[model samples]
Target: MTALNSKTITLKQLAKTIDHSLLTPDLNEEDVKAGCELAARYQVASVCVKPWDVRLAAGVLAGTDVKVGTVIGFPHGSSTMETKVFEARKAIEDGAVELDMVINIGAMRSGQYDYVRKEIHEVVEAARGKALVKVILENAYLTKEEIARGSQLVEEAGADFVKTSTGFAPTGATIDDLKLMRESVSEKVKIKAAHGIRTLDSLLEVIDAGATRVGARSTAAMLDEFAARYPDRLG
Candidate 1:
């Protein structure tokens, strides 16, 4: 992987790559608000809050470049197709500009490729161009071949991005997984890395591996480090 010139990358550029994640189940309304505030302050790419918070987050991030994003079929992708579509539609109506949807992991692992593809396609259709759809493959439960096949399915379904994990899985994004996903899809399909990205070095590793976006709860610490290293680039 070719390295990103850390010296040349500004804080704004790095911030734009992050989706400040606030998906923990125990978080309250105040927590969501604070997370949105943090995202606004740093001007990150988006704030990926829980589905219920999409309207609130949208209100907070209005007029800013920071987009409002939410998940569909979430940590587990067992939800029925109709439910997932409804979730996507409601999120979009609530001002979510991005939707990170989980694929049917059990079905995918069972080699139900057609079912998985159809589900993703339905969700994409439901978004109706209102939001950029990201299909999460949950790589922790899949082999390399499955990951590759899943990426292809996402591209075929017309989703905007292929993602690594749901962060509720046993493990998160890896350099190898990111590279494999990148190779599996064309340049038109972007890649997002979520979970366990806690430091500047780790974040850069994923970026070099081909991830354009990352989901993380450690936004402040990571950006603070970048600020310390490149004070002039802060924006």
Candidate 2:
């Protein structure tokens, strides 16, 4: 992964920090295929696709460094805990190496933290050794206190990363949220800021604020910027 708390980066390290997104509902199969190709060419961390497209992404990304990732409970975190676990297992079976699951937003806002913790823990258990679990707090819907608590819950549940928003949220990752999340969890759990982060500068800003991964759609542009600006990193 790229350095999470600094500005320094290499082309590959920068690429490794991006989860190139293709989770939009409007994308057709060909669009996803093309996106997978683009992700491979850019050498990004993974291609985060919808659950249905996991197999396609895995097939295309096989033998390449890019991994297959998909959402669980998706943009909304209303799915039942049992349903989320099943969804996670199914995605893993379909070759998803990473799973970004939305925390039960309503539950967190409702102060049902134990319910939230159990839900995340079950998914983590389901994904154990099979895939990495990243919990999306969907910061747009959470208060600052809720954000910190959610971050702690996610880490306590043994998730691999704590993510900001769902990209469908009204707002996405902010530097303050990133810093708070970083402080809430030990280095053991990394941070992923999604939604509205597109350019290299924005990506670096999040990383500098303690994000270890970022969900992005402009994989090409961001990597291109890195290449142009840091030619020495190419080697």
Candidate 3:
């Protein structure tokens, strides 16, 4: 596991951008609870776990500043729109503060732009202003044009954030993709550069390219290294 030890030198600054993750298939309720505890201890931005565990995380994190987050149609984005929407609404009702929904790769590849748009909007609507909606574009599977188009569609669908990958794909977030995504969206929308952001240089590149958030499981180690390297910069 990659640690959050970064050259930034400050826990407070690093935690603000990290989204503590616990999305592996083998992760059980106990693991999720432990992850939530770690996130709370670190005071990271949020704790992202399986959709089924959103309520549990919320219950554990209640009355705290840490937000509860989960993924919809995760790992695979091939699920029907109805299913994704159903999952989104349920997760929100279960106390999820953020929804990260993956886009259907086949539909996007087939040039079914409108279909993708509607799918995202469906989930966004289901969120009902309770949770922030983030559309994961799976950038590795698409061409540059497709990435740009996906970003536009996500923006049009009223999503709060546009994400790079689910990390199950062949490739993860890249600097080029981050630039394209940032360029494609409105300034009001946030850009999250996730997927294999294991190093300080890599994470900084994304932030410099306008990524306001990062999904990472290695918050603890990365921030530690960052703090050691740049002790004076961090609070």
Candidate 4:
């Protein structure tokens, strides 16, 4: 994998790493349709839908190279490991190519590192070779030590990616968390900065800190603002 740098990759390349999200609880068919259209228009990597919408998202993106991604254990990682594994398998069967599982924050806070690591491993194992697993740290609820420890545990558990936040937390990805995660994992392991990262400055900070992927619903808005301010750059 390539490291984050000032040089921009192609839209196709950028899209390949993005998980275009529409995770609101009140989402409907219309919202999914709009999300799919925007995802295709932006050439985003995947459309991250709710579990029930995975099949719908899969059908909408069937003819395109765009993949389907879904959440497991959702905004909170408080679900039982058994339930999370079941959700992961079911989502893959529903045509999801990527699985973002929320880590059990409660367990981590209790210093049950083994429990946290085991939970991540269960989902990863359940994903089998069918779906890529991204473990969400929900960084806003965690301390620096917790972030570092969780990143390491995620690495040890063999997840494909370690993510910063769920966007529902009090805070989201920070430069410190991204830097710590980057320094903790191997080059092959990917790092994603999500939540509360809506501006170009913050994005650049995380990217510079070594986050290869970013999860943001405001990507389209941010791109529009960028194009307006730097018309020449858009060319």
Candidate 5:
């Protein structure tokens, strides 16, 4: 990865690359609203919330550039393909512009590559071009070969992005995983690095490693650090 000088990247550019996360299980309506508000204020890429909160988040972030995103099958990718498709359709109906769907880790580990690929394809079809689909590989459990294969499956399955982790796994996105994923996918397939990216330096490192977007719960702190370090660049 090439070194990125913080001075060259504007605050807005950095903020735009972040997908502010609000997928915690215990979060209530108030929490979702607050998260949406924060994303709007910060002008981040999107507010990735739970499936049920898509409408509320859309309402809160209305008139702002921040999009409404939701997870399908959530932390665990065990949901049946029908259920995931339903979730994708419902999220889009509820105004979610992006859908981050998890692949069946168990199935992938079991060598059910065709099943995983078909599931992703169905979810993308369910979106019907209304939302961008990001397929999460949950790399914490996969071997390097699996990661590479998953990246190929994502491209073949027509997903817009190949994500590193779901953030609920035992581990999170690593530089090596990001590098491998980048190498595995085609140029058109974007990368999203989620989990364990809490600091500005970490975010930049991943961006330099080939991530076009990120899922972050520490959106405020990181952006604040960027603003403080380059006050003149931030409006």
Candidate 6:
């Protein structure tokens, strides 16, 4: 593993760390298609799209190294576990290789740890090993303690990544939240920072704080700036 914090690595390695986001509700088919093209061009880690666009993105990204991912329970994580599970299966069937599911926020805030944990486990099980599960803590709505607890539940449920936000929240991933989440889970679990990583500086800052993956809307600007600043590392 190239140290996650190391700046001396291939542009492809750094690009692989970004999950290009195209989840805005107003985006239509053309927008998604163009986004997929850009993702392939950059060889991003994945493109997180709305559920309906999963198939489209899957089609566009076929034979490319970039993966397809979609969200479950979305900006708000209040859906029934059953619905989320079904969504997980549907997304996988539609060619999503990664699933970013939000934890039930009300349940978590109520300290319903069992329910939260059970839901995450079921969603993972729903994937049936076909997709990687990234549990969104939606840190914007959580207290520091809740964030820590959420991180624990995500790992306990066997999810691959513990993510910070859904990007619909008032705030997004913060360095403190990333550090805390990184500390909360064992090394087996990865941290994904989303919801405010807009610049190369911010992206690098989050990785240094312990994010192995990030959700970013400013994908081109960040990568272009990176290439400019580190031409020597564009291997």
Work out the TM-score per prediction: 0.96, 0.97, 0.93, 0.92, 0.96, 0.98
Task: For candidate 6, write residues 31-100 as lDDT tens digits.
Answer: 9999999999999999999999999999999999999999999989989999999999999999998999
Q: Which 10 consecutive positions of candidate 1 have the poorest summed lDDT?
A: 1-10
By lDDT, the better pick of 1 and 3 is 1
lDDT of 3 by residue, 1-235 (tens): 2323343325576678778888989998899988999888878889888988988999899877999999999988989999999999889889998989999999999999999999999998888769999899999899999999999999999999999999888899888898889899888678888889987777777777777789998777877777787768667
Tens digits of lDDT, candidate 4, 1-235: 4664646643344445567789988989999988988888777778889999999999989888778999999989999999999999999999999999999999999999999999999999898789999999998888889988999999999999999988888888888788888888887688988887677566556777887777878767765565565555543
Worst 10 residues of 2 by lDDT: 1-10
Error of 3 at 14 (Å): 2.9
lDDT of 2 by residue, 1-235 (tens): 3354434578888889999999989999999999999999988899999999999999999999899999999989999999999999999999999999999999999999999999999999999999999999999988999999999999999999999999998999999999999999998999999998988789889989988799999889988988998888774
lDDT to native, each model: 0.92, 0.93, 0.86, 0.83, 0.92, 0.94
Worst 10 residues of 5 by lDDT: 1-10
Residue 103 in model 1: lDDT: 97
- Per-residue CA lDDT of model 5 for 198-224, tens digit only, reads 999998889888888999999999999
The clash number for model 4 is 1
Model 2 pairs whose backbones collide: none
The true-structure Cα RMSD of candidate 5 reads 2.0
The lDDT, on a scale of 0 to 1, for candidate 2 is 0.93
Which candidate model has the greater lDDT, 2 or 6? 6
Kindly provide the TM-score of model 5 when superposed on the true structure, using C-alpha atoms: 0.96
Among these predictions, the greatest TM-score belongs to: 6
